[model samples]
Target: MSNAIDFISAYNTIDSRLRAIYRGKGNLQFSDLVRRCAEFNNTVRKYEDDLLLCARLRNVIVHESKKDRIIAEPCDDLTRLIGHVAELLSMPPRLSVLREKNVTGIDAEATLAEALVRIAQTNYSNLPVYRKDRMIGILNNRRVVRVVGQALERGEDVDVFLQTPCSQILQAEDMNRFYRVLGRSDTVQEAIDAFEDNRKLLAVVVTESGDAGDRIVNLLTSADIPMLIRILEE
Candidate 1:
């Protein structure tokens, strides 16, 4: 009912969740748990200072109090802040907020010229390339630039190269390092982690089951990182 009670309840919830996260490990201190989880959990890392301070405040509220006597009460704002942190840790915001309707996919065999025209017309810098209904790679400006730069260096007919197939150009693009697959159910935090973990990642394709072969339901590019971060911080 009181701010102190509300604060303690949310703090306990966060504590329990942290223990569950590292279940089977030896009993650990709350500060230690927060520190260790921060290494892998972006939410924890983002609010590390606040959580640690709350832990200390929690000790004073409980340990320093006498029977039937409250020593200190947390402010209403602090109570609500902890409550929000608990809710986020329990159920993070999913990628649905970033979902794009009518995602366009390009045929792998489409010529570079056609792809460029589509890119220019649609204003979509990244387009998934598919062959036989299976996604092979993405067509992005960086890939096009690289191909054109190489053509000019060799004095090869740039027009001839523009006639090359999207699939052909994809072969020279580093497929393994440029993209990742995530399920539609994945949270925004996971998407942020995917981009953070791979500096070279160009895009994240979301599908029904996180398989590259599945039809893409949503796509996230580096351009969306700032927006995602804002969502989390907000």
Candidate 2:
């Protein structure tokens, strides 16, 4: 069959399989349901082996039909289509279990010298800076290194070459403010939103109940949030 035909057929098969599973093709015999697993799996496997569908099938199964009203179990077909959600489920957070040499700080001026030191010491391209419990800016390793060389050649004080604080660099005239902060007790999802959407990677991790949001117990860097999420999600 043509690529387009095969593509349509695959989607139809997924839809048909879901309809059969949930729409009560009225509860087949247990033995018959087991047989259905083999037949459905074989059908899905054929499409999975196709050149175009091999990779595309994974994405389709994952993203498509998510909101569709259907109840399906961990059948062989699903295993063939998705290939063990358990594998991805088990991937440890790249953030947690990562080295924590990058220590905590506040109002920390990111002189090029200091930024360079942190990058070299931590072997990370990004360094989080803070100003007395407030996240100030990220010291990018590449930029800091490049700007330091240029400043030094001119006999300039590299410390004076610090980039403007992150708020200044990322000020949003149109975007509304996000006062949505995490108390030390807040769920990790809050941290993820701040990191991904708010662009506040080195954002403040606050404690609300204690000191009534005045105290800063921890810092939530982009690195830390993802590490936590990897553990939670998988």
- lDDT computed for candidate 1: 0.86
Cα error, residue 68 of model 2, in Å, equals 34
Worst 10 residues of 1 by lDDT: 171-180
Off by over 4 Å in 2: 1-102, 106-111, 124-181, 198-216, 221-227, 230-234
The estimated TM-scores of all candidates read 0.78, 0.33
Which residue pairs does candidate 2 place in steric collision? 107-130, 107-131, 107-132
lDDT of 2 by residue, 139-210 (tens): 454445565577789998655655533333222321224223456455454455465566634443454432
- lDDT digits (tens) for residues 115-208 of candidate 1: 9999999998888899999988888888889988999999999899899999988853465778888887788878888888999898888887
Compare the candidates by lDDT and give the number of the best one.
Answer: 1
Flag regions of model 1 displaced more than 4 Å: 1-6, 16-28, 32-42, 66-75, 148-157
